[model samples]
Target: MEEVEIEPLGADEARDILAVAQDRRNGTRWSVALALGLRQCEALGLRWKYVDLKRGTIRVFWQIKHQRYRHGCKDPHACGERLHRYPCPKDCPKARRTSGRKHVCIKEGQKFCAPDCTKHAPSCPERVGGWTFVKPKGKSKRTVMIPPPLIPLLKQHQEAQQAERQAAGEAWQDYGLVWCHTDGRPIDAGQDWDEWKELLRLADVDKDARVHDARHTAATLLIEQGVDISVVQGILGHSQLTTTKRYTHITATLSNEAAARMGRALWG
Candidate 1:
């Protein structure tokens, strides 16, 4: 397997990020990621119905995904005059084999058509793909306990959402997502990513850190606290201990602590 570089935020850095996020809209969303290690899809798909504030738990059953479009029309070739793909010119130097004998022009070449031609799946009357909520993989579908510090943040988020709902009035779509647009529609993944980048900038944290790094940070934090590896695996909902280990970054502090414990056990 290819080696992955795991860069997790320090405890102080995590605190700074959370503190900055607290004042922004949907700020609790970032906190959930850093504290609970929820995937982006899981966080986006989280619904208010699945969050039991009274019980201090969240049921992670679903994830939001953008499915690719498929040709739903009866005749893909005849769907539209411009939609039909044509073979490359016989002597065209740019033609490359797409299958056993067929060849097509380069994607940017204007002289010859490429596969799918000018087909616009989104414009298809019977297009069959878009953003939708689906069940998470068996292992990823697990309940997460709300951290004590996060409970009040969640409540505050609820109050803010309620205010937004009232302001939106009849314009709200009411998708029931915990984190959504002001109109209650699900937030697009791209928009969510942009927001995360802005949060990092505001927090003065690593600007290059990806949103997924929050999961790594959570795993590292849990391990640093001396939480058992198996327990961290369960909290992360990883199917294997190896996966959890991959997410956990062992820092110098953790290494030194381990050495001290070993020395005490052997010398004492």
Candidate 2:
């Protein structure tokens, strides 16, 4: 198979990004995304039951998607096709880039197919439903250990969420996600793009960075910390050892050190 070159931020950049997000609203969620190599969907799907604060572990067993919830937008700024929480802007064009099978462009708010742009357009799902959460690309599911610091932050978040729930009373939706809207609804992935880009811009990081890069960030950091490749493979739940190999981006010093270690092992 051809090699897949993964792009993770330099350690400094990653640290800066995490620092910037540390106190932000979705800070814990973003931290987990980088620390545990979770796909956005996996993070979205997380529930309280899956987390074990006492044990310092969390389960990764399901993904979340809010399907078929439609908002009928009106003209002048209309998404006439009923939408889920993340509806496309009325001005969204029919022709746009397809970022995986979700079809709707989170950055551009453009629907996968142009409005009546194709003969099969009527048959397309985006015309009726909303974006679907997918698994980590071409990989199976696996759990990874959480960083020690994040565990307490998670506990604090849960406490804060409980306070919010009490404040809202009957208004809280109780979807039980670790990452969710203030009212306990699923976060709209399409709507998050604007804020994500803005976060990157404010941090002086690449404004064009995709959120999926967090998975790459976690994987690369693991390799840098001297974790075994086979362990990373299991953490990432890759179908093949080679699939996990694609995520390893080593620094020159580390590469040189690896060579030296091998040489010592051979000569000494």
Candidate 3:
């Protein structure tokens, strides 16, 4: 495992990197992935179905697995770390009344009261009216609430995606997001990461920065801006507060600020 470090990128460097992706026409997904500290799989697994635009809430579920359905894995220790699927809720807000797929319907007030529903597997529909949530076997699950600063960008990106879909016209199959390769296929995680790093290099950033450091960057910024450590911990989805604290680096700027504050308090 790579040791985590507090590697801070200059704002100009960050901006340049983001611009490169935009210039290349790689959607905001890459930038958003960096901004939100989302894992590669989590970002790749992102779909229109999970995004709640009106409320500005993005559901952090679903995992793109390598092979086999991890939902049924019995390993108690390994299960939580494994990728799992996010089944559509019968009462999901995103669900719409589509004539095509019954499972895709988001009918309001209409309970999925079918005698046997396809969503609830194994058990007969007669026994269960509907599924409240998917029960994927996982214990090491991590979920982080996004910061307020990132919410507006998410909304803007959603609108941009809609515009792109409209422009695509008949060719639009609604890949739900623009993170995938040109063909709408899932990009290989490692290769995609390498490409992003190369983009960063072209933008004049240090070659040593890892894609995962963005999470650290977000948390570090919060701390430097005087946000409470506990709040940063919650936003970073760290199981322990110590993990969150590790990302924060007290810079010379902070030290100077503290000295100036003390001087004013003592002199003034």
Candidate 4:
């Protein structure tokens, strides 16, 4: 596979992109991408339940695969035929339940476990949970947080989204303040990206910039602003510090700026 490079657009370019993406849905997707530094899939997989518009926070829960719910034999030793969740080794009586919530798992007509099941159950029926973010084909999933400056914009955007939903009459799904469609469906991230790219072209910016670079921009901006590296790591949701160290050069940049200021004060 070819290496994927993340190159964030300058603020001017981001502004151009946003200006060109005139559609409300597309704009919201771009705003979310710039704010949360979410991968394409993470943004697309975002559900109504995960966003707290009131609190200005987005929670990512689960990801949808191409065969999201396609069930089949998961055990390596079992026959190589794909099975539904009900027929999987995890749900079979012969399989050992390792650990996890049984929650309410009803496959076909038979009951698999309670709805509130956890990982502690002796015969865990639920498949092991993995990372929530997904990549389309060549991309990787990266979880990053919204910047503080964008918080107000997100709030205003939520209000506008709510007004739009209300104008749609009774067809809207009521999730109470979520910045989604009137029917309460999560915005499709891939479609959103396509629209955003078109918008960038319209705004007279380079269309070659990948959406993932917005995340890199968010991180780079924060580090340039003298925000602590650890805090950036938390906001970006990086599992390790090494992943965040790439932006340490911004810290040096800031230090150079500070030294310049000191020189002006001392000599001039």
Report the number of the highest-lDDT candidate: 1
Off by over 4 Å in 1: 1-3, 69-127, 247-249, 262-268
Model 3, position 94: C-alpha lDDT score: 68
C-alpha lDDT of residue 251 in model 1 = 74
Model 3 segments more than 4 A misplaced: 68-178
Q: Whole-model lDDT, candidate 3?
A: 0.57
Backbone clashes in model 1: 0
Order of the predicted models by lDDT, top scorer first: 1, 2, 3, 4
Cα TM-score of candidate 1: 0.77
Off by over 4 Å in 4: 1-4, 61-64, 68-189, 250-259, 265-268
What local distance difference test score does each model get? 0.82, 0.69, 0.57, 0.57
In order of appearance, the predictions have TM-scores of 0.77, 0.69, 0.60, 0.56
Q: Is candidate 1 or candidate 2 better by TM-score?
A: 1
Model 2 per-residue lDDT tens digits across residues 1-268: 3225456766777777778877777678877877887776778778888899988888787787756643232231233333322444546675344653333335444344345323332334445445354454555566667778889998888898888778888989877878777788878777565655666777888636777777787788888888999988877666789777766545554687789999999998
Over the stretch 193-236, how does candidate 1's per-residue lDDT look in tens digits? Answer: 99988888988986488878888888889888888888888888
Instruction: List, residue by residue over 120-203, the lDDT tens digit for candidate 4.
Output: 322334434322334333223333444466666666666676777778778875534233455655555565567667776787
**lDDT for model 2:** 0.69
lDDT of 3 by residue, 1-268 (tens): 2245567665566678777876454546656665555555666657667766556556666645343222232332233322223435766766554755544443445443343323323232223222122322332144455546656666666566567666767766544543554434455668767887888778888658776765555556567677788876655556677776675544555667788999999997
Give residue 182's error in model 4 in angstroms: 6.7
Poorest 10 consecutive residues by lDDT, candidate 3: 128-137
Best prediction by TM-score: 1
